[model samples]
Target chain A: MKFGVIVFPGSNCDHDAYHVISKHVGQPVEFIWHKETDLSGYDAVIVPGGFSYGDYLRCGALAKFSPVMAAVKEFAAQGKFVFGICNGFQILCEAGLLPGALIRNKNLHFICKHVNLKVENSNTPYTSEIAEGEVLSIPIAHAEGNYVCDDETFHQLEENGQIVFRYCDENGEVTDEANPNGARSNIAGICNQDRNVLGMMPHPERACEVLLGSDDGRNIFRSLTKAIAAHG
Target chain B: MKAKVYVTLKPSVLDPQGKAIHHSVELLGFEKIADIRQGKYFEIALDATLSDAEARETAEKIAKDVLANPVIEDYRVEISN
Candidate 1:
């Protein structure tokens, strides 16, 4: 299973994502530049986290227009898996490949720390290995991670079970509404209507190893591997 | 020609930054504070040769396609006459 990690300008997590997938997980992986328009050979693509384009206009605003996004969009349309982590999520949303937008932290301050996210829906291939309601501790570093959407869309998300993850307490209870990021309904991650694409604020790749203090995120990658194999 | 794009969160959408600012304003003892909502402003300069309808179409298309998420936000374009 070959994985292609897309690296945009100011993408600091390209190497980190590559390290976890290729070195740690033993999945063949390669780097795809932001300018690259071809993604035909790879089975999956990952938009790693970082302040792309120096986060000049907005978190992922400028990076959305990169040449690679055009291909990413095309690939996603063909039923391929695309993972967007943190700032990568912002870019996906900005590019209209996903819904909602990442706003500034509710408190208007940069938030960096480990957070517990409860798996809401595991029916998707990305979370198939994760049991529903299971809590996974992952690290989040961002100033704009607040997810916002209209009431109708919010209702639709709930109705369709598209809400994938939410911030929660240590005991696996979702709480602390007045938290740092100010994400709506405590949402930390979500998926598109088809559930093929995933965009989350937390870094699962960072938690795939014990050296990172937890292996809770390994299941996500493993699940992807299983799903791809099954698809074959 | 100069154009301004106004992007705002759709109705019934939560605006945490705006809410926080409203709270701060209230805390500062602003008795007349009613409400607040955050939005984005863009100033675009385009070629003068384009017709008003062309420019408006361009702005609206981008807004609907990219600059704003129609599911959660709405945008309006204002062009200089």
Candidate 2:
């Protein structure tokens, strides 16, 4: 199976994702430029982290209108895997592939550190290999990582098992203190109702190697690859 | 004609930057402040061929779709010479 990593104008982590997918996930991957509109050959698409459109107007607002985003939207509608990390997560939300919006961090700080995340749901393809309640040490670096939505939408996400990962402590306890950003309900990641599109603030691409700090991030990619291969 | 747009966060969304500014003002001895919120302002120049009503409609559409995210913000449009 082939994987595609999208490269926006300001995307700095495109190569990182490409390397991880090739070396760690043992998959063939290519860097897809922002202007590219075709995605038929790739089994999954990854939107790597970085400030797209220089994060103008809002974090992901401008990038949502990019030419490739229209294709990404249609890809998600076909139940293909689309994973967005950090700014990519913001872009997915802005593009309406996912629900809610990411706002400025509550403390108004560009926090960069390794935070623990509890797997809230493992049924989705992104987290199928991870056991529910498993805590992953993943790094998050962003100034606007706070996620917010209205009450009704929040309820539907809750009722649909769409919540995939939640900020938590070492022992897997969800708490405000563990929430690096003031995201409602300590949400760290979520999937669409169909569970095909997944967005998270954590940079899994940066944590794919033990030399870097943790290899826990590999589980997410591993899960996706395994699920895709099994389906074929 | 010139169209002005005002965009502000909805009351339900927290404005951390505005809060920090409020705290700074309190430290500056401005004791009468109840609260503070931050917002954005934009000005658009429209072609004269469009009527005033048409300008309003165009400005409102821009404000709704491009200038503001209705999920967490409210926008107002004003038209003038």
Off by over 4 Å in 2: none
Each candidate: what lDDT? 0.86, 0.94
Query: What is candidate 1's CA lDDT for residue A107?
Result: 70
Q: Could you give the DockQ of candidate 1?
A: 0.49
Q: What is the TM-score of each candidate against the true structure?
A: 0.88, 0.98
Which residue pairs come into collision in candidate 2? none
TM-score of 2: 0.98
Docking class of 2: high
**Model 1, span A119-166: residue lDDT tens:** 999898889999999989888999999898877778988998889989
Candidate 2, residue A85: the lDDT equals: 96
Could you list the chain B TM-scores for each candidate? 0.91, 0.94
